[model samples]
Target: MLKPILKLLALCAFCWAFFASADVLTVRQDAPERYVVKKGDTLWDISALYLSEPWRWPQLWRMNPQIDNPHLIFPGDVLKLVYGPDGRPMLVRDNRVVRLSPRTRVTDTRPDAVTTLPLAMIRPFLTHDKLMTAEQLNGQPYILGASSNVKNATEGHILYARGELEPGKGYAIYRRGKAYIDPETKDELGHELNLVATSRAFRAGNAANNEPASLQVMDARREIRQGDVVLPSIDGEALPAYFHMSRPELAVEGLIIDTTSNLREFSKWDIVIINRGTNEQLQPGNMLNIVRPSPTVVDGNDGKPVYLEDSSRYQRLARNFGHEQITMPREMVGHLMVFKVADRASYAIVTDTFRPVRVGDHIISP
Candidate 1:
């Protein structure tokens, strides 16, 4: 009798802790009982209607077995919120097929399901932008010269390249951008390859005979110049439209190394590259919180402290000359979701911003 009583107490404690952990999924008081999924509604937008923190959507979907895969929620489906037997909120989807006729009946319309984010915002990065290693960039075919010795060529111009080139094949022209270096260790990560133009090989180069290949520029976003790299057109991976939003299982942290627009400061929806990637156990759909390191303060003689932002160059250096300095607490500025991961770095778009973010800002697992 004593053993049975203890077992029941242990189970009760375990159940209590399990439900208590979900307190963060606070449902809004004005949340509707049921909502009709719309054509343009995103998973993030829909989740924000019911929970305060929309990033915690995986928790809400887990309680309800009806929503096996959140990505499959169609536009015409109906979402109904109901409580489970354990008194936890569950979001249930009603995707019943509507019959149009008895003999020739219509099934459920499975149109393009709503993605987690606006695909238009990230489609270009997914297709064009890429990171290349130093060796890879150096080995690719380069524009040796242009027909008629044109210094800068546009569309429909013939250019000659000297490398192993294939005839009748499409190639993407790229200009070398900045080199990504780890902020902490100062190790060279990779070089940013900016897509400039695209072309097709009119004639293959023969390295054995020292013959250069002929290429005709098909499309030009910018003027194609000599020394521009020519590589096979990047047919990027087939990534899913909807990303499974989740935190990293391991503690991961890094600094923002670069931005797509080359802006000094970035905010929501801006694409930025971080120093961490698959090497750091980061992957697509991992959300990280951005933290801005606090500036150091110098204590002056007049019973006041001057922040580094307000201090002069001389005053900032005076900290080494017996001036007391204090480092303030770091602040959380925003959150970013990793959309693409390379070997040593990853591309992430700012999902939420509470303050202005800059390069070198720390990104930690949420």
Candidate 2:
């Protein structure tokens, strides 16, 4: 009897230590008893309703066997709260399907079908913008002039460009902007691009010495000017394949290089590029946290190092020449999810911004 009791006590102590070492998933106090899935809803949006930390959705999923896969939930699926064998709250589906038999049915309603996310929100970004490396875009075809040499070219305009243009092939026009560099190593990663327009050559190709090829603007997002680059147009559906969300399997860290609008400060729904890429094991759907580094400061009382914000009191005491500056702790400003990935860089849109994100903001694993 004494031996059995000793073994039981040891097992209890081991279980306590293991549980304490892991994160405790916190549920919302006022979590809904049931949530009906909607067409425009995403996993992130639905998870937020029941979990305090929506990023830890995998934890909630483990407790519920009914919600085997999030991708299977349709628009009309009803998520009901249930208790697991362990007495923990679990989100289970109480699916209800209503079949419609119309006299002249023409289309498949697909009431049971589901989508990974709200495609409308990310559809614009799928084809419009891209970052290019020096070796990739250098010496490529470029717009040399516009009709009558105007500073800007709009729709229904003719543009002259020097390149080997096949008569029917379409080209995407891009305006190159600033070079995005790594904040830590200060290396040029890639050049920022603004897609201006796309056009197909109509007349003919121009030789190296002959007049440049003539093309008509088929679509215009902005001003297509002389000196803009002309590259092959990407298929509209290529990016949507990565729309399925998946957590990052590896740990990663980096900093924001720039934004789609070229703004210094970032806002909600802004597309931003981060320095990390596939080389760092980054994948599409990997969520990251945006953080601001703490400011460095000096102590007023003694010639010692201190980490604090610059205040009026500190300004008066800074006349002393020996005060040392120290860096303060990092603070989270927002959260971002990677929707696209390249070799050394990836593009992410700000999903939740507690504060406006800026260039050079640190990106850390969530």
Candidate 3:
């Protein structure tokens, strides 16, 4: 059911570029020499057994050109860690189908595979309208004046929209989630848009005649309201359950602006928004390391706060000022991969979390 991912036209090339690794990665000391693929075994699962940093699977997996795409990954396949001619570690006798197969694709040989994360964890975010800025929402088709005279309407309610609507077509109702900003630069990234409901056009509107369209709400998570943005209905069929893991073409250093659930203890499988995106040459499947920033602590010995930076300056004035800021090391708190990228923001899910991801967390090379 996974087509060539053409649906992501904006990033089809970048998405497909995920088939290979850009760098040589490190392997875990306790990693097994061989692993057999099993049903329900994700790429992340298999990669974890071999690499210290599991997100670098692309590097170790760069062995066989065939297995790069990984959509064809199947159970019962044997994988062994063997060195290549260059004396670097790589998988041996592994059949990996990188995204692009220049030769004729032989569908008869491979098995269908799922993604690194559970589908339920990311299904809600697989839409085009997840990130919307105020400027982008301007003049967008919206609910005319609310579904009805009532304050809020639920399922089976009739709604009206003030924009061009095609007869028999469908549209989705969405509300803003959070105002995301760049943690480093303090620039507004964009607003997270949530799909509130979906409706079908029983009637169509004409811009020339200023005629409004009527729609019957088919589903509603909450209330559909006036001024709510109405966009093309999300096509469930177009969603890609399989996301090939790849490394970023460029160095990615940014901050976690927000979490999807806004929990202080951000755990695994949680969706998040970072401050990097297409502007930084990022694309879907690019892996990242969620670096937790160290807190500044006061220097107890001198009775002054230890300054992490300006050590020489502190050394010169320490006896006189009794104050120094101590810099802490950034820890590898979690791992994530970009699934969708907007102009200035991206949506990624935490693949693994050693600690809770918070706002302003560092995102560096994986």
lDDT of 2 by residue, 1-366 (tens): 999999999999999988965565667988888888887776667777887656665556564444445555668789876666655666777764334355533333454544444555566656676667777788788998887768899889998888778788888899998887887888777776778998988756567667688889999989888899998887554744224444577787788987777788977678888998888888777888889997876655565544555445645366465454556789999888888676678889787777889998998987
TM-score for model 2? 0.71
Off by over 4 Å in 1: 1-40, 62-69, 72-78, 94-112, 236-239, 295-324
Highest-lDDT candidate: 1
Order of candidates by lDDT, top first? 1, 3, 2
Cα-based lDDT for every prediction? 0.82, 0.75, 0.75
Which candidate has the highest TM-score of all? Answer: 1
- Candidate 1, overall lDDT? 0.82
Model 3 TM-score on a 0 to 1 scale: 0.74
- Candidate 3 lDDT over 1-366, as tens digits, reads 335565566476665555434345667788888787787777777777887677656567674765645545667777788877876787654555336547755553443563566666777777544886678888888887645587677788888888887878888899877788876777788888888898888788887899888888888988877778888885664567566676798998998887878687787778888888998999888889989768755463655454445345546456456554466788989888898888899999888888877777889875
Tens-digit lDDT string for candidate 1 (305-362): 7887888777777777867678898899988889888888888988878898899899
Give every collision pair in model 2. Answer: none
Error of 3 at 30 (Å): 1.4
